[model samples]
Target: NAGVTQTPKFRILKIGQSMTLQCTQDMNHNYMYWYRQDPGMGLKLIYYSVGAGITDKGEVPNGYNVSRSTTEDFPLRLELAAPSQTSVYFCASSPLAGVYNEQFFGPGTRLTVL
Candidate 1:
């Protein structure tokens, strides 16, 4: 399976700019998630969706939003981005609930805000 894929492998944003990190999967997974990982820190959940048309906020959803309109796409929108939002964002998915299955992660999209 293609698993999950994220675009714009690297990005730099100024203090109040906006951007969208795209994520897509070909595994037909029922669960997908967006997470941010800071240097030396564990991944922090930003948002997640159990299936198409269903989405929820996660541990660190601030400054971010998501929509699951189709089974293959779930993108993260960063509005009025701040330096604090700078981090490596990863998109992941699993065929089953994360509580019982291992998550497959994208290569990652690195964002830097100034």
Candidate 2:
């Protein structure tokens, strides 16, 4: 089974444009998350879903949105792309929280906005 997958490995956007980043997993994980990493910074969570139909915004969720329609899919949407939003986006999933399970991460989508 594919642990996690993300589309459009690389993308370039103009200021104010929007795009949806896709993420999916075949491990049937119950917890999913979206995070972004700037050039020289740590990963900052954008949004997350505990289970299908349940979602919550994370630390830095200002310009982003997410939805979990099924156990295998959780997609991230950017409303108005900005230069500050340009970063490497990652999708991760774990079997459960509060346990000792490792989260599987996607390759990441690198976005550059000008």
Candidate 3:
């Protein structure tokens, strides 16, 4: 699988703006996650879903939301964009049955808030 096939390469948002970061992966996995990393900082988990119709919050869930009604799409909604939310976001997926639990990552979306 090519993992994440495509996404907007860049996005610019102003304070209070809202947008959805679309993430789609091959339909072979049962787990998906959303994470964001600020400059020189480690990635922070925003949300994750183990399977369809089951979602859970992660370390950083404020100002963000996720839904998994299907196995292929896991979109992250960023509401009321803020400067503190400026970061590169990643989408990852792992199969239900794996030996090492390796994850496949998307190319990442660069979001800037002003």
Task: Give the Cα error of residue 68 in candidate 1, in Å.
Answer: 0.5
Write the residue-wise lDDT of candidate 1 on 30-71 in tens digits: 899999999999999999999999999999999998999998
| Model 2 lDDT tens row, 24-60 | 9999999999999998899999999999999998999
State each model's CA lDDT, in order.
0.95, 0.94, 0.89
What is the model-wide C-alpha lDDT for candidate 2?
0.94
> Which of candidates 1 and 3 is the stronger one according to lDDT?
1
- Give a tens-digit lDDT track for model 3, residues 1-114: 667743776899999999999999985789999989888999899999999899999999999989998999899999899998989999998886457777788999999999
lDDT of 2 at 32: 97
lDDT against true structure, model 1: 0.95
Q: Please list the residue runs of candidate 3 whose C-alpha ends up more than 4 Å from where it truly belongs after superposition.
A: 97-99
Candidate 1: Cα lDDT at 61: 93
Clashing pairs in 2: none
Q: Report model 2's TM-score to 2 decimal places.
A: 0.96
